[model samples]
Target: MNSRLPENELDELPREIIDFAKHIAALPDEFQDDMETAYNRVVDSVRRRRRILGLVQEALAQLRLDIKYLMFDLEMTRRERDELREQLGD
Candidate 1:
């Protein structure tokens, strides 16, 4: 497989990823600080999303277990109802 990116897509990449030290050194101090702050915010957002995703997965697992129990209960109730009907007929 060709590892090289198409030229058009390459142009859309951030300069820092292409050449980190050179790109950061070329920028003014304030701009660099802003970039760092933005990067930190993105990292924090990803962490929060991962934590929420884990909680959602746990809830879904619990929901599946609850559904299984409810299905079993429904089947048991149906059997009891049928037995009661037979007894009443006899």
Candidate 2:
């Protein structure tokens, strides 16, 4: 198994987690199984959470843009209605 973690992962994950993985990697082959599995699980979980967070942030940004567009559309429609009413009154 590849024990070397990617540099980006090293930067994103907590130092303690990285240290623990390194410790597990350093173990003798016979002693590495259970702890290695646990470490892999933790790393996977963290990465999954980060991905989910990024998606949510992107969604929020899109929602904000949609809301601004809707607001502008509403204002333009109101102004047009008012202009038509003034022309009819004249």
Candidate 3:
């Protein structure tokens, strides 16, 4: 499969599963390769996918934290602006 997803690759299916399918497509012919090696590759791919997912989850959590802080800061700034405006009689 291509390094990047093509338009057609987008679907209800998760990207990891789609990537796994792409990996499967590139796998060596079953009868031509050692079974153990093939199995190991498949296992490794699954492990990699899990790691990627964990990282994505961690990033999302951090983003949520950042957004929460930003919202609080925005409210505080708006309140300060209103106070300043009242003091200035504007």
Query: In terms of TM-score, which candidate is strongest?
Result: 2
Cα lDDT of candidate 3 equals: 0.68
User: What is the model-wide C-alpha lDDT for candidate 2?
Assistant: 0.87
Top-lDDT candidate index:
2
lDDT string for model 2 (1-90, tens) is: 344777876899888888887788788998889888888899899989999999999999999999999999999999999999999999
Write one digit per residue (lDDT tens) for candidate 1, span 33-63: 7765665465456557767989999999999
lDDT of the candidates, in the order given: 0.66, 0.87, 0.68
lDDT of 3 by residue, 1-88 (tens): 3244455534634566666656655767773346445644655666678789999999999999999999999999999999999999
Work out the TM-score per prediction: 0.66, 0.82, 0.62
Alpha-carbon runs more than 4 Å astray in model 1 = 1-31
Rank by lDDT, highest first: 2, 3, 1
Q: What is the C-alpha RMSD of each candidate to the true structure, in Å?
A: 8.5, 2.2, 8.9
